[model samples]
Target: MGTLFRRKSRMVVVDFLPLPPVESKRLNKAISETGFCSRREADRFIEAGQVRVNGAVAGLGVKVTPDDKIEVNGEMISKEVPKIYLAFHKPVGITCTTDTSKKDNIIDYINFPERIFPIGRLDKPSEGLIFMTNDGDIVNKILRAGNNHEKEYIVNVNRKITQAFIRQMSNGVPILDTVTKKCRVERINDFTFRIILTQGLNRQIRRMCKHLGYEVTRLKRMRIMNISLGKLKPGQYRHFSPKELQEINQLLANSIKTEEASEN
Candidate 1:
């Protein structure tokens, strides 16, 4: 009997000896990764006392283990929630913002049953393929400058295409205080050309055209890495196939994955 009690006492002591620093995640990122909301929005909700870690209210930047019970507005968040990845054909005049306060926000426009955000912006005036996903973890890996993911676009300028223009655009053009990366530019015909870029800057193509005295009459993204726009029409969205997702995972295998620490 004494031996069993001593063993029980030792077990209790061991349990209290501070758990091997549980592999934890910040409350907001975990929430966002579960298709609940964006991390920024999660932060806002946490500050407003709508989020809880374990049974207690959560504070900003609180670290939580996977086993911790988390809730928002009295509803428990499910870690097993399905992840959604989509190819959305953004039409001109629709915004890529996640902000619900704006009428043009993509989230509101799509009205997906669950919350989601566009992976990156497709400026309101520009149209074409853009990715939207409920998984916040992959957003940075795909968008970060270091990854070098390719995005192809077909562009139409106001003036006729010139060989000099092709050469300048392909080699590099100074924009946004830095020279644009050398990208593949192929002349499709006069006034239209195709460009595949590994880097994205604010209104990059438009700015590149303006630098050379050209006005962009039309600009539409055709592809993003392994995914293509295909025949998806304006304001339409389709889920990624398992094979496509598999290939995408393979493509990003060497690219960076956003871990919990850096995300906070």
Candidate 2:
């Protein structure tokens, strides 16, 4: 009996020994790990008193362990949520913004079951293929202008075919306080042309056409990097195929992902 009692005592003492510290990360990071939102959005929730850790309001920069419960706006955030990636065919007039207050916002239009944001934006007046994902890390890597990812567009201008116009566009055009980079521009028809650009400036194709004395009648993006619209009609969306996802991951393997510093 004494031997058994001693063994129990030893077990109790072992249990009392200090445990290795539980890994903890910033509150915003913990929330973002669930794929619920980006770190910036998480910080906003913290500042707005919409985030709670273990039933207490969370503060900015607070560290949380994996075992801690995290809730946003009274909804418990689960880290097991699946990451979503989509290629959407944006229709003209749909704004590429997350603000629900704004009419015709892309988020409202898609009504995705899981919260997601566009990787980059397409102009409201122009439309075509755009990427949407819940993985915030991938968004930065894909959107970074320096990454040199290709975005292809088919543009219709109000003019007759001119060899000089194609030559000038392919060479480069001055716009947005800087000369645009040389890109591949090919004439498709009398007034239609295809352009693949590595840099995304504000309304780049439109501005380039206007600079050359042409007005864009229609602008539609056809592809982004390796993904093409591929029969997805306007306002339609499709999940990224496994092969596409694999290729994209391979492409971004060496790409850099960055986050803006938030004051909150």
Candidate 3:
């Protein structure tokens, strides 16, 4: 009886020693940050028996520590490096997509070291400057629906443009279920015009001209925000200079500050 009691006491004392705390976040956060899915969707994947930890099926509420192995859909997930930003003068007929299946996708046209995506879209049929970046955060800042970043385009119409049409365009023509925002329009020649817009509504220029009973013969974007196409010819690209980058960063900072102030 004494020996049994001593052994039991020893066991109890050993059990009282501290154990490591379980990590709070697990597979869900990893999967979500990898852009595989949202947190809620990750949880569903766990519950559905689609996730694995160390090659074993994982269930919801599974605790994942730093050393634990994790996989989703039979693929391993690893941390990615910081994203890169780039600028390219997209020529006509090149689709602004990464998909290789498309005959003339942007990826095939520009041979860059990193995988980048356009901040916003430039239609395949149109030609001009386009911003490309892998940094998703900047994409939101530049392309947010409410952002008023000026985009300038040189447009050539099929027919002679009259002063009345220019007045109507500047005065705000109705299109896309809303009155077009006030914009800057200048007649450069008999059929050529320079337009600066604060809002991007799909093929806005094309739609606007169509509404005014004019056909756009050629359209080319010359500027976005503070960056200009400059002397860049079609199908050319270059890195932003330090000053250019600083300017863009400043613009984004100011825009964010303005938005926050308005909410308050």
Candidate 4:
């Protein structure tokens, strides 16, 4: 037989009996891991006394185990909920923001039943495939520019493309006070081209074009990593097939989730 006694900040086991390991984690992380909300939001809920664990109000820094009963706003939260992953074809003029008050925000436009946010954003003037997911961890994994995940785009410019332009773009163009990384740029026609980038500099494509004295008349993302836009029309979305999700997980297996790690 074994008994537990409180000794300062530690629990003492009498009789030196062995006990099964109780995997534990911070309460906020537990909630986030369940895909219910973000860790920040979980902290807010705890501070506001809206979160309870085992029928007692939870506090910040609380540690919880898988067996803990967690609740929020008088509703019990399951320890595990099916994760949602989506590929959305964003439309031009739609802002990729979660703020419902913002007009033309992607969240409101999609009107999904559950909370999901865009992995990364496209400019309001551009349109194409973007990822949406309740899995917050995967966002940083895939978005870390240093990971060298490929994002392919089709672009149309206001003027005819030239050989020099293609060479310059492929070699690397100076943008955002830094030189853009060398990438694969193929001329599709006099006015259109295909580009694949592993960098995510702000307005990179447009700025690169402007620096070369060309204006981007149209831009559309065609693929992200191993996922493709396929036939999804603007403002439409589809869940990732099991095979796609499996492949993405494999690709991100070694990805770092920190911004600092992504900086050159």
Which candidate leads the pack in TM-score? 1
lDDT of 1 by residue, 1-264 (tens): 122235643743223344486688889889987988767678899999999888799899798888989999999988877999999998888888877898788888888887788887878888999888888777767876568888899999999999999999999999879998899999999999999988778888999999999999988999989999999999999999999999999888888744211100
In order of TM-score, best first, we have 1, 2, 4, 3
**What would the TM-scores of all predictions be?**
0.84, 0.83, 0.71, 0.81
Give per-candidate clash totals. Answer: 0, 0, 0, 0
Task: Report the error of model 3 at residue 15, Å.
Answer: 26
Query: Which candidate leads in lDDT?
Result: 4
Question: What TM-score should be assigned to candidate 3?
Answer: 0.71
The lDDT for every candidate, in the order shown, is 0.84, 0.84, 0.75, 0.87
Worst 10 residues of 2 by lDDT: 255-264
Across 112-223, the per-residue lDDT of candidate 2 in tens digits comes to 9888888778888888999988876687677666777788889999998599999999999998799988999999999899999877777778888899999999899998
Model 2 pairs whose backbones collide: none
lDDT string for model 4 (112-212, tens) is: 99877778789899999999887767777787788999999999999999999999999999987899899999999999999999988888899999999
Assess candidate 1 and give its lDDT.
Answer: 0.84
- Residue 259, candidate 1: C-alpha displacement in angstroms: 12
TM-score head-to-head 1 vs 2, winner: 1
Quote model 1's TM-score.
0.84
Q: Residue 191 CA error for candidate 3 (Å)?
A: 0.8
Evaluation by TM-score, superior candidate among 1 and 3 = 1
